[model samples]
Target: MVKQNFILFMLIGELSKKSGVSRDTIRYYEKMGLLRVSANRRDNNYKEYADNAPDVLKMIAIGKNLGFKLIETKEFLEFWEQNDTDNERLTEMVLKKIEEIDTKIKALTVFKQNLENALIKCEP
Candidate 1:
């Protein structure tokens, strides 16, 4: 009795295949409140996800690409979906991430230079 336009529902394996995110990561995100908490439960207790789950995964990926941790990404997405005014809190998060990256770059540069120096010492 399903219509051609009916929405598709996917189980964890299908979602993992469609979204390219592992089932473990999906489960983690679901536990962490990033994905839909009320995934439709079948009589056997298996969860069914909406077709749009892939899009949500993409949003999470985009947030991580912006240097946000999983928890931060969830919070940022919530704030973004609900807020309209000045995003000072999000700005602060971005600034802090930038500072962290800067410190890491400095340490990495020093480490690279040390490695180069060590290699030079080994040259004949």
Candidate 2:
């Protein structure tokens, strides 16, 4: 098959190995429309994914590492795949996530301080 420069069309197992995402998660991604197998491939029981499928899985992994929910990752992927998508929208999601993380950190800091104060009182 004539391949794109560095892109690879691969079955789920090879894709999973290359992408470090498991088969079950890849199936879940297909179910969620995060990944897709062609209709012919689906019908023929020959599931070959498009070349960029691995990249999508990597992006999902990055989003998860950044604490984005699955839905958020889906939205991010949709936005990213759009031809006219701009950085502003992506920045908005990331900034909002950072704000969320900051809020959680503040709450956790307060909780830790409260526990520390309680421990101090108990020690005396």
Candidate 3:
């Protein structure tokens, strides 16, 4: 039974719809320890997820967009779960990611300049 205003338990289909993540991806996240569902199965034997599952999925998407690997995202989730006052660690990770992106952007810019030079050299 879902609690009122505290926790809303939803099946996989509802989670998939609300989170904008596919059922198969959600299942894979569960297998990778990136997500958790209630151990108590519904009468129909479907897994039930808490309301926060959607929020967690969104966090995963954001991490992926920032170039985090699945393992890194999982570690971030673990830090988030362990303490609310862990912003320092989270900030450090974000800063590191920013440095990596800066390096990639610099390399890509140089590569693009070389390609443009090659194109210019190709007469006609």
Candidate 4:
């Protein structure tokens, strides 16, 4: 079977398609310094994105999955970009995230118990 060549460079629209994020969201990320682009004003004039744009999008998705607000995600991304070699710091961040998740889980468990108790008292 022949392998298709993956495109390395993409325009904003194509990146949006590949990233599962709206163009406006990508633009907002760009404004917030979470993403960067290169433009070819001589030809197509549209912004050119790096092959790593997908990774950036994945980071955003991961942040959302971890219950981080956008601003918090931005700050985390900034820290990640600056401290690639600091494994200890990364571990600390991960531990903090785990703690936050634990807190949320406890709250959810309490809420579920309250709901179940109320349901047990309800008439059919």
lDDT of 1 by residue, 23-121 (tens): 999999888988873344668888877777788899899988877799888877777657633688878877888899999999999999999999999
Stretches of candidate 1 above 4 Å error?
1-10, 83-85
Quick one: how many clashes does candidate 1 have?
0
User: Who wins the TM-score comparison?
Assistant: 3
Model 3, 16-99: lDDT tens per residue?
998889999999999999999987777888888988899899989988987999998998988877765458778888788889
Better of 3 and 4 by TM-score: 3
Compose the digit string of candidate 4's lDDT tens values, residues 1-124.
1112454677788888988999999999899878877643216466777787878889988998888877777777877667664677666777888898899999999999999999999958
- What is the lDDT for 8 in model 1? 71
Choose 2 or 4, whichever is better by TM-score: 2
TM-score of each: 0.73, 0.81, 0.83, 0.72
Off by over 4 Å in 3: 4-6, 82-87
Tens digits of per-residue lDDT for model 2, 49-119: 87888889988999899899998899899887785367787888888999999999999999999999999
Per-residue error at 59 for model 3, in Å? 1.0
lDDT of 3 at 122: 100
Backbone clashes in model 3, listed as residue pairs:
none
Candidate 1: give the clashing pairs: none
User: Every model's Cα RMSD, please?
Assistant: 3.7, 3.0, 2.4, 5.2
Which candidate leads in lDDT?
3
Q: lDDT for each of the candidates? A: 0.80, 0.83, 0.88, 0.78
